[model samples]
Target: MRQHSTSTHLAQKSSWTHPIYTKKQILDVQTAHRKASSWQDRVALSTVKVLRWGMDFVTGYGTYSPISISVPKTRTMTEQKWLTRFIFLESVAGVPGMVAGMLRHLKSIRMMRRDHGWIETLLEEAYNERMHLLTFLKLAEPTWTMRCMVLGAQWVFFSGFSLAYLISPQICHRFVGYLEEEAVITYSKAIKDFDDGHLPLWEKLEAPEMAIKYWQMPENNRCMRSLLLYVRADEANHRDVNHTLGNLNQTDPNPFAAKPKIEIGLPQLQQNGRVKD
Candidate 1:
């Protein structure tokens, strides 16, 4: 009898390598909002606001204020509370992209037409959001209640978003754009909290090894604050990309498919040296 091989290899690479970011690029990520012009835009923005309110209430997330403003002492979030909110946010955040991508893929197959590069970007966004959730999981394990919340939220969101995407891809994309805007705000507030010495434990904490590898983070900037900066930067990009996609016709080619020259007045310095808006 031939001897059986006993060695096993571990998967060492991300399916989609995250774009590397310079410290300046990460720190420069600022919150942005796209005003609602059309009815679709209004609907999308309204939905995001309602959902944000519900999630905040359920998660006990405190309202965010500028660093210059004094936060109420009673409303302060502990490290664990922050992790709880992050976990819940990321769990739902990964839904829209996957739903949109899956629908577009099936539609393409059924109609015998190409998706014009939309599928890849949408799927990649889902993957990136999953990585965010996984990285947070490494820092804090979710309790049974949290796990239940995630399960219920994912099922409801996945179903609702799929139907919405099938009905109006533009509005769904717009909704995601607005949702990502909130994500950037949330992460920005977290970073500010860290900077203000509100999150003491995170001050000395190093990022998880998984996050460092995924973000290709630098040796010097591998702390929790840097990790939040990286995540906030990703959310900011998603905010821009989804809003742009919402503006295009369904058949239009994805502008992000090929690297462009500059993006929203910022150079995508890490990828292709620059990107277009």
Candidate 2:
């Protein structure tokens, strides 16, 4: 039975290797987005202020300003906006995982104990975010100045998050939860813009090869909107996981649990040649 299930899963995954969507189908996705509410509509943007105040509150306004100094004032999803955002955010996103995983691993070895299996999840989170960075670089193709910015941002964030995790794991996990909440909002806005015909850089562009493989995108759902959908789902999953971890005590059993899966769907086209989604 296990073998049969495994084989079925592999077949389902392999079905995405070939393109199954038409240009009309991809355009249908964008058309449907025009009627949807965007990420900016969230009250969290005004209250949490992920791009500015949320981060400031996390680090104590002046304590770590370099992280935000290089960013621009615009909040939309232009090519430049997403490029810089992902480059910096992905760099920092991987930090908490590494720090938490290493700390747990060391603690287990030292106490001659086990971690209740939390270390693997943390490490996988770090690896997945790192891949997100690499995937974006193929699109952004950063200049020297942007590369420098990435270098500086990674160094500061690594140090800051490491220190925070070391001092208080609960607070560190909470900060990550907040960060991912911001990430979900950011990607939603990007998806709205891209699907609403605002981003020329992504106009009629196919999903990145890496994104296609990582998300195991279905033949009909292999477009930019779908890509963003998968990425946002990942952030949402991370948000829940970190929030759970933040509330857990070391004595708690099974702090690590499986994340919920996001459903994959595509915009459908009607026989009359109109989008139905």
RMSD of each: 7.4, 14.0
Per-residue lDDT of 1-277 in model 2, one digit per residue for the tens? 0011111122234311323434444333321111113342233224334445644332222211224433233433456666566666776787779888898899899999877667877887887777678667656666776677667767877787677666777666666766777777667667766665666766656666666666667777766567666666667767767765665655343334333211111111122222221
Root-mean-square deviation of Cα positions for candidate 1 versus the true structure, in angstroms: 7.4
Candidate 1 residue-wise lDDT at 184: 98
Query: Model 1: per-residue lDDT, tens digit, 1-277?
Result: 1111213242567678887888889878999888898999999999999999998888777744664456565567767778889999999999988999999999999999988788999999999999899888878888899899899999999989988898999999989999999999999878877887778888878887778888988888888888898889999999999988887778766777755422422232224332233
TM-score of each: 0.88, 0.66
Candidate with maximal TM-score: 1
| Candidate 2, residue 130: how far the Cα is off, in Å | 1.2
Q: Candidate 1 — which residues are off by over 4 angstroms?
A: 1-10, 63-74, 259-277
Candidate 1 clash pair list: 262-275, 262-276, 263-275
**Cα-based lDDT for every prediction:** 0.83, 0.59
